[model samples]
Target: MRILSGMRPTGKLHIGHLVGALENWVRLQEEGNECFYFVADWHALTTHYDDVSRLKEYTRDLVRGFLACGIDPEKSVVFVQSGVKEHAELALLFSMIVSVSRLERIPTYKEIKKELNYKDLSTAGFLIYPVLQAADILIYKAEGVPVGEDQVYHIELTREIARRFNHLYAEVFPEPDAILSRVPKLPGTDGRKMSKSYGNIINLEISEIELERTILRMMTDPARVRRTDPGNPENCPVWRYHQAFDISEEESKWVWEGCTTAKIGCVDCKRLLLKNMKKKLIPIWENFSRIDEDPRYVDDVILEGTKRAREVARQTMEEVRKAMNLMF
Candidate 1:
């Protein structure tokens, strides 16, 4: 099946990114699927339009990081979303078919605006961003979109757009389904959500020692006042990491028991987490460290992927124009 996935450029990736998506990308790329992965630079602008200075650097870093994490550009098509001007052009075309109310109904839109504390929700591009997302999927004729539950709403809108186009024009697109990833959980240093804005993220490039130090600061059961205090693992962030990373069922059970019995302090639990995280991230870091040295590699990869993506996009747009009679 054709799988479509992407990550926005954020300078360097982190454990949250891995647990959230990159690990899943690696698995799917290896699963013999035609994966179309792109750096969603445009989407980054939706949130960070004020900070355009780091975009190019972040874009390059994202490409390199994905390469380092075993997303072989050879096996999958990797490109930048804005490389082809057609994405924006098609986004405009799709905007006409979707309603403002529909865009408002996107659950994440309000959540993002409130979370980001934006000065205004007035950016036209920001509000209707899902239309651009639809154009991205439909352009690739993607059979499935590999995403987390958070993005299910966006893909649903994409399906609606595809359905609308088919009903208005011809049977030109497929209704893509959300291929939810069997993703692992990756938390931040503070044991909250791993986000760049939070400054609690363990970047993919940081040393193992740094990874350990970050884990050490993670929040635990507040009820556990002292090391001797028995705590509930259910409320500990460190325990959450164990649930995601600890492979041995016995080990996890031990964590639960130790925490519930106050045998292990949150510090020890965090130390254990850092050790396991290093085991997972060290190899990816090693593979991707030299990626930036290749000056032409990112450009070449984007050019090739864009070439193929544009071909598919052109085919779709041809039908769209013919159906809408743009050229007749």
Candidate 2:
């Protein structure tokens, strides 16, 4: 399958990013699928346009994170979104075909605006980002887009756009399907959705001491005010982490029994989780350290991937122009 997915270059990737997206991406590539993963730098501008200073730094950091998390450049095409000018061109073309009302109806549009009320998200770019996302998928003629549940709607929009384009012009793009991620969303230490804006993420680059402190401080069942009080693991955010971090069935049952019976305190539960999490994250951090030390290696990977992506994008644009009678 020709699979495509991307992440915004907003900030350093956290454990949420790993469990939610990167791990799934690595699995797809390893499964022998054709994957095109890019850093959505242009998409980042939709929200963070005010601060262009750290954009480059964030983009590089994102790429480094991808490399560190076992997203082998050899197996997948890894590029920055802005590196391909075709994305912008195709987006402009797609914008005309898509309706303003349709874009507004997207659930995330309203939700994100409410979430980021502090920022002025009234820009046209912010509203029509789904169109650009469609261009991102269709440009590569991706058959499947590996996305979380929240992003499934965007893929649906992409399919709508694809059908519209094909109906109006000629069949120049594939109506891509959403390959829903198997991993559930990972929450932050504060028990809210894991997000950079929330300031609750456990970044991949976090130190061991910081990781320990963060895990220990994670929110547990609000009802369990005292150590003696029995806790509900279902309500505890730490328990959610256990579910995500490959905790064994036996260990999970033990934790559940202990929590419900007040046999284990939140601190001990956190400590146990911390030990298990470190075993998985430490290797990824080691990989990140090695890649971070060599900036040129990361740059080369981006340059090569961008070139390859552009080759495919340019061909798609040619077919699109021919289909739309714009070749003249």
Candidate 3:
């Protein structure tokens, strides 16, 4: 399957990113599927256009995160979205075919507008991002898009756009399907959705000491105010981490029995969870350290991948032009 997915270079990636998306991406690439992963720099502009001083820095960190998490550049095409100009051209062409009402109806667009109400999100670019996303997937003629549940609607819209384009012009693009991730969303330390804005994220580049402190401070079952009080693991955010990190069956059973029976205190449970998490995250941090030190290596990877992506994108644009009678 030709799979494509991307992430905005808004800030440093967090543990939520590692398990929620990066792990899944690495699994897909290892499964022998063709993958195209790009940093959505243009998409970042939809929200962070006001201050772009750190845009290049964030982009570099994002690529580092990708490589550190085992997204092998040799196996997958990793590039920047704006590096290939075809994405902008395709998005412009798609805008004419898609309705303003359709874009307005997208749940994410409405949700983001509310979430970032402080920001001036009244721009046309902010509203039509889904159209650009469609261009991102369709430009590569991707058969499947690896996305979380929140993004399934965007893939649906992409399919609609593909169908419309084919109906109006010619069959040049595939109606891509959403390959839903099996992993559930990882929560922030504060037990809410992990977001940079929340300031509750555990970034991938966090120090071991900070990781320990963060995990130790994670929110637990609110009902259990005293150490003597029995706790429900279901309501405890630490327990959720244990589950996400794949704590062994024996250890999991111990945690469940202990939490419900008041045999284990929240601190001890958190300590155990911390140990298990470190085993998984330490290697990724090490990989990131080596990659971060070598900026040239990161540049070479992006340069090569962008060139390769442009080759495929150019061919797609040619077919699109011929279908729409834009070719001279």
Candidate 4:
């Protein structure tokens, strides 16, 4: 299947971000899917509008993270969204087709407004992001999108936009489907969503010691204050992570039973979790450090990706202009 997905290159990506999305993207590519993964720098502008000095830095780091995490550059078309000018032009055209009220009703827009508390800076860019995303996906005429559970609404809207466009103009675009990725729910140290703003994330760049320290401070069953106190793995946020990071099946079964029966202390559980986490990340961390040290090699890759992406985007825009009768 032809799949399109993007990650916002705004900050250091955390474990939650990886298990939630990127890992799945890599797996899909490995399974012989045509995947288009881009650094969604334009999407970052919706929130971080004033502070864009880090765009280049963040984009660079995100690309490094992708490579580090086994997102093979050969299997996937990784490009920068802003590098393709057609994304902007196509987004503008898509905005005309979609209604303002529809964008307002989106759950994500409301959530971001509350999260950022951006009473005044809730600009049109923030509201129309999903449309831009639709433009990004439809530009390639993606057969499907790899997205988190939160993004299903936006994809549903994208499907609607495709249907409307096909019915009104011509069937030039395919009605893209959402390939729901069942990603593990990785929580923060503070038991909130693992985000940079929350300041509770374990970034991929974190060292072995730092990773262990972060996991050690994790909150488990709040009621289980003592080692002897029986805990509920179902209620323990840290236990949720054990299911995610540890060896996935039988060996993990040992940790699960131990946690619920008070046979294992929180520290022991975290230690077990940390060992598994480190083992998984060591190679990825090595890959990132290699790219981090050599900036030129990564830059060359981005430039090549940008050039290839532009060619495809330009051809799609030609078809778009003709369909809209704007190809004069």
After TM-score superposition, what is the CA distance of residue 131 in candidate 1 from its true location, in Å? 0.4
lDDT of 2 by residue, 97-191 (tens): 99999999999999999999999999999999999999999999999888888998999999999999899989888889887655658888989
How does candidate 2 score on lDDT?
0.91
Ranking by TM-score: 3, 2, 4, 1
Candidate 1 residue pairs in clash (backbone atoms < 3 Å): none
- Residue by residue across 150-173, what tens digits does model 4's lDDT show? 898999999999888888877778
Off by over 4 Å in 2: none
TM values, all candidates: 0.94, 0.97, 0.97, 0.96
> Residues 51-133, candidate 1, lDDT per residue (tens digit)?
89999999988888888888888899988898877788789989999999999989999988888884565699799888988
Q: In candidate 1, residue 244 scores what lDDT?
A: 64
CA lDDT scores, all candidates in order: 0.82, 0.91, 0.92, 0.84
Candidate 3 local lDDT, 49-167, one digit each (tens): 99999999999779878999999999999999999999999999999999999999999998998999999999999999999999999999999898888999999999999999999
Query: Which residue runs of candidate 3 sit more than 4 Å off their true CA positions?
Result: none
Judged by lDDT relative to the true structure, which candidate is superior, 1 or 2? 2
* Residue 253, model 1: Cα distance from true site in angstroms: 1.8
Task: For candidate 1, report its TM-score.
Answer: 0.94
User: Candidate 3 has what TM-score?
Assistant: 0.97
44: Cα error in model 4, Å: 0.9
